[model samples]
Target: MTMNAALIRAILRIIGASLVSLVFVTIAVFFITAVLPGDVADALLGQAATPDAVAALRHSLNLDKPVLVRFVIWVNGLLHGDFGVSLISRRPVLAMASERLIHSLLLAGVTALFAVPVALVLGTASAIFRNTLFDRAVSLLTLCVVSVPEFLVATLAVFIFSVQLHLLPSLASISDIHSIGSFLASFSMPVTTLACVIVGQMSRMTRAVMIDALGSSWVEMAVLKGASPAHIILRHVIPNVIAPLFNVIALSLSYLLGGVVIVESVFHYPGIASLMVDSVAARDIPLVQICALIFCAAYLFLTTLADIVALLSSQRRHAA
Candidate 1:
C-alpha cells in the first residue's frame, strides 16, 4: 500500500476506536458513580437535617428521576460541555475541576521533564552495557522501585527529606503559579516521587525495545561501515525505535495523568486526582464524574497523538 493510504487507514482506525471508547467511558463513569454506597442527600444534609428536608433536596437535584433518564440527561449535557454543578459546593463541576486540572497538568509536565531524559539516558546506557554490572544494577534498582507502592515511596521521601534533613515541606501548598520558586519548592517532593516511579517504568521499556533493535543485523552493518557510535545511534538506531517508544510515551502520559492520587494525597497537592478523591469521599457525583471524564479524554488525546506521530514517521520511512 502507498504511504498516504496506510496513514489514512491508521487514522480512521484510531478515530473509530476513540469514539467507541468515549461511549463506554461515559456509561461506565455514570453507572459506577451511581452505585457508590450512601446517598448524596444524606451526606450533604448531615445529622441536623430532617428526613423531609433530605427528600426535598433529593427531589430538587432530580435524584428522584429514573436511572436511564438521569443518565440520558447527563450524557446530553456532557455532549454540549455542560458538566453540571457539584452536589456539595454548588459550583460548576468543570469550573472546580478546571483549576485542579491545571495543577495536575503542571505536576505531570514537571514529572515528564525529569522522567523522560533521565529514563532515555539510563535505558540507552543499560542497552549499551547489557549484562554488565551497570546494566544489572539498573535492572535491580528499577525492579526495587517498581516493586514498592507509590505511597510507600512518598512516605519514605517525606521522612528522609522533611523529617531527617529538614530541607523541604512534606505537604505541597503550591497555589500560586506566579511564584515559580515557591511552587517548585512546594511541589518538589511530589514531583520527585512521581519521577522515581515513572523513570523506572519508562527506562525499562526503552531498554527492552532498544536491546532488540541494537541486536538486529543492520546495526552490525552500520558498525562495519565505520560509522561513529553517535552517527549509528542517531541515523539508524533512534529512527528504528521511535515508533515503539511513542507507544511507551503514550502509556506513560496516561499514568502521569491519573495515577498520581497516592502521591498527591501524601503531599497534599491540589491537583485533579486530589479533587477526585475528595469528591468521592464527599459523595459529590457530578464532580467525580467530570474529573474522571476529563482524565479519560486526556488519555485518549495522548494515545491518539502518539499513534499519529508513529504512523506519520512510519509513512516517511516507507516513502523513503
Candidate 2:
C-alpha cells in the first residue's frame, strides 16, 4: 500500500477506536458512580431528613429509575450536550464542566508551550554530552525532580517563590489568560509544578532514545561521511527515533493531565480535576460522571493523536 493510504487508514482506525472507547467510558463512568455508597438523594436531603422526603427526592431526580433507563436518558441528554444537574449544587452540570474544562485546557496549553521545546533541547544536549558533567548534572536534576511528589514540589515552590522571594503567587486564580501579566501571575506556580515531572521524564527518555539512535550504524556512517553534527543529529538521529519520541510526548502530555488534579488542588486552581474531586467528595453523581468522562475523553484523544503521528512516522520510514 502507498504510505499516504496506510497513514490515512491508521489515522481513521485510531480515531474510531477512541470513539468506541469513549462510549464505553461514558457507560462505565455512569455505572461506577451508581455503585458508590452515598446516594445523591441522601446527600441533597441531609442525614436528619425524613425517609419519605429522601424517596420523593430520589424519584424527582429519577434516581428511582432502573440503571438502563437512566443511562439511556443520560446518553440522550449528552447527545444534545446536556449533562444534567449537580445534585449537591442544583446547578447545570454542562455549564460548570465546560468552564472548568477550559481552565484545565489552558493550564495544559501553557505547560506544553513551555515544556516541549525545552525538553527537546535538554534531551539533545544530555544525549550528546553522555557521561560528561553536563549530562550527569542534567540526569541528577531530572531524577531529583521526578522523584519528588507534585504536591511537595508545589509546596516547596510556593515557599521559595511566593513566600520567600515574593516573585510569584502561591494560589493561581485569575480568570483571563488573554491578559499576559494576569495569566503569568495566576499560572506560574501551578504550571511549573505540573510540568516539572513530565518535563524531567521526557527529557531523560528522549535522551536515551536519541542516544541509541545516534549510536546506530547509519548515524556512524553519516558521521564518517563528514556530515555536520547538527545535520546528522537532526536528520539521521531524531527521525529514526521519531516514533518513540511521539509516544513519549503523548505520555508526557497524559502525565500533565493527570498531574493537573494534584497541582490544581495544591494551587486551588479552578479546573476540571478540582471539580471532579469536589464532586466525588460530595457524591455528586452527575458531576462526577461528567468529570470522569471528560478525563477519559481527553486522555483517549491525546493517545489516539499520538498513535496517528507515530503511524505516519513509521510509514515515512518505510517509504524512505
Best by TM-score: 1
Poorest 10 consecutive residues by lDDT, candidate 1: 174-183
- Residue-level lDDT tens digits of model 2 in 71-156: 89989999998889888778998799999999899899999999988888899899998999999999999999899999999999
List the candidates' TM-scores in order: 0.95, 0.92
How high is the CA lDDT of each candidate model? 0.88, 0.88
Give the per-residue Cα lDDT of candidate 1 at 42: 90
lDDT by residue for model 1 over 103-214, one digit each (tens)?
8888898889888899889998999889999999999998898788888989999999999999988888875445767777787889888988788898899899889988
* Clashes by residue pair, model 1: none
Which residue segments of model 1 deviate by more than 4 Å?
1-3, 176-181
Relative to the true structure, candidate 1 has a C-alpha RMSD (angstroms) of 1.7
The global Cα lDDT (0 to 1) of model 1 is 0.88
Among all windows of 10 consecutive residues in model 2, the one with the lowest summed lDDT is: 1-10
